[model samples]
Target: MPFAVLPAQICDVEPVYDVYFAAFKNEPIIEFLFPGGGDRKAHTAGTVQWWNHDRNGYTVKCVDTDTGKIVGMASWDIFWRPGEEGAWPKPDGAVWLEGEQRTKAEGVLVPLWEMHEKLFGKNRHVYLPTMAVDPDCQRRGAGRLLMQWGIDIAEKLGLAIYLESTEAGLPLYSRMGFERLTYVHMIHKAEVAGTEEDVEVPLMVKMPSKAKGMAFEDWAKRGYP
Candidate 1:
């Protein structure tokens, strides 16, 4: 079915949540986020509050025309402003290995603020966060559609899109023109019965607007910037 990329307005919050949960079904952080175990109602309420707080966040939902269902979703926002903390709540009470992970993850945001200054040099930028596609729709081109839409919007506005992603999603971003900025360790402390273990997350980056002449997917296959 043909996919349509539409601006995700306030009304689209619930649908966007569906895509988010579906995409992060296996992610441990998500499990921590919804400790009650995938309560759709709680998730919906949280999303509504988040959207209300950050009205500037832009979302694009990929809807399957035939089913008229939102199969994928991606969100971006203006770069980190001084003293402004972006959303994405910290994982709740850690389970053994997760306690320590939270501390490290919390610290990463500070460096992001520093990096924002270094990369854009005091000028505002755009940051991409929480991108996801339905489990059944994996590898079906929906992610690419949303990514291209993000690139188009960012370029038209003459802004740079920044994001930190997992190792699994690296190829997708690279294909869409994101470059690997660093492979820094993401430290997260999780506690299980008062014990600690650090969870390491790899970080990367890309400048889609700057890669206009290149084919991101091809470049991604070759591990090019």
Candidate 2:
């Protein structure tokens, strides 16, 4: 059956966060963000609230056509037009992070701001900040499906796609026509329990073009974008 990719509704936030959290559970960045098995339910609620407001991003989920389950998800910051970006204000109850966790988030976002400006200053593009498939759902082309959704939109808008790729994601990104740019050290020594090393990820880009990632199955033969 053909894979199904759809706009993640607010109602799907819980499962979306479930896949995201589970996938990133062991990632160092996840440890820094929510030390010691943080509140997953609250994070899910916050995601719903935030989506109710206007944001320059999109979250999509890949469904298991056979079982009707959300097996993977991806969140993208779309900068399709020029001269976007201003204040960081959100609704009063829109924030999820707080206290130490909030600070850790800033530690990561702050450097990302600088890196983005330095690299693509004012350039229109799509940024895939986070994406994940359920551990049990790996190797099923869900990742590729979620990525193709972004690629399709980015190509249609004539925008380049950029992302900070984890070590495991490098090969897949490369297969998706993304070129490795440079390594970005967002933070060093997370200072969280059980994590005390520098945090760095590779910067990668896939300019809008005809090529698409044919990594899993026969997406190329299937005529995917």
Candidate 3:
């Protein structure tokens, strides 16, 4: 099954959301963030909208070339310098959340964002906020294809790439040269069946390769291929 990676368009939202929801639905941190999970899909949809509408990030999709179905997706945002022209839009609120859901969501996200900024704010880097593949499409190279899109761009721009990795994603990221910088933990307020008492996310970073000006063609020939 061959796939092609390209910049995602507005029309790609639903499929991209589907992949993200399916991939993270059972993730511990997602369970912590969404609590009971009734509004998880809606929350994810809103996020997809934010990513697409913000106009300050890159959203890439990996589509099955034969059928044109999106098998994987990845989104990256460059945190701009102070007073930069195109800063990412701040969310007005988690409109998709309500009552307790809203409280829980913010409870978990606020500190996480603060920690992220404190740790990585000084560097001009790319942030990989979301990446997912269809559940059935795991281990088919879709992840690598999607990840390579960011790797290539980061290398070209001489910037490091940062991501918060779930346990399942740690191995693949390690293989790609990302090193764990720190761990972020969030406690669950309400006990849920099959959910961990706490969610631990690893902050990882992959610095640009020292061989900085390497052309894509040469980089591919050397190792990426």
Candidate 4:
């Protein structure tokens, strides 16, 4: 089926996260975050709250052109200058899941932040928090369509694109020219499971100013790199 990419609207938060939830529901993190499977209402509320005050965020969706149905979604936070991302205002996370369901989020989130800072520090870059294609739509190029949105921004702004990749996402990201830096192991001790659980996600980056097409631009040298 054919697909097209476009910016997502506020009304899209629900469906967008629907695809995301379905794509990641089986992941250990979700199970660890919500304990029992979470309903769409809670997931959508959290998604909305996350984007509410995030001024630097960019979100996009992929639609099945033939059927006009959404197939994938992606959200990224753009850091245009040094220290800007850190200083930016944020939404009150307390508005999301309440009680322990919310507090438990600190486990994966804190470590993820530590790893993020460790990787880029105060440098400007694009941070991909999450992206997902519906399970039925896998291997159909929807992922590439969604990713290219940020790639275009990163290339135009000359910033690096930083994202964590699952094992299944490796080949797609690798083919898109992202270099695998290292594995970031996020461990969350599950009080319910009574054991330590960890997810080994690959850290990847695509640095700008290295576009193959740039070789042919007016400012480029006579020959390609």
The most accurate candidate by lDDT is 4
lDDT (Cα, tens digit) per residue for candidate 3, span 113-204: 76656555444567898999999999999998889888888888766677877789998999988877634443334343235455556777
TM per model?
0.69, 0.79, 0.78, 0.79
Judge candidate 1 at residue 76 and give its lDDT. 74
lDDT of 4: 0.73
The models' CA-based lDDT, in order, is 0.64, 0.72, 0.71, 0.73
Segments of candidate 4 deviating more than 4 angstroms: 81-103, 183-198, 210-225
Ranking by lDDT: 4, 2, 3, 1
Pairs in clash, predicted candidate 2: none
Candidate 3 residue 10 C-alpha distance from true site, Å: 1.2
Instruction: State the lDDT of candidate 1 residue by residue for 1-225, as single tens digits.
Output: 889888887788888877787777676666444543555776577677778876457778999999988999998775434433443322332222245455443344444445544444434456676789999887999989988886776676655567767667888987776766543344444542122555554445555555565443343444433
- Model 4 per-residue lDDT tens digits across residues 1-225: 889999888789988877888898777677656567766676777668867876788899999989988999998888885455443233344344668767666555666677777666556678888889999999999999888989999888877788877778899998998877634454445653234654456877786776543322221233212
Model 1 CA lDDT for position 110: 48
Number of backbone-clashing residue pairs for each candidate, in the order shown: 20, 0, 0, 0
Candidate that would win on TM-score: 2
Arrange candidates, best TM-score first: 2, 4, 3, 1
Which of the two, 2 or 3, has more lDDT? 2
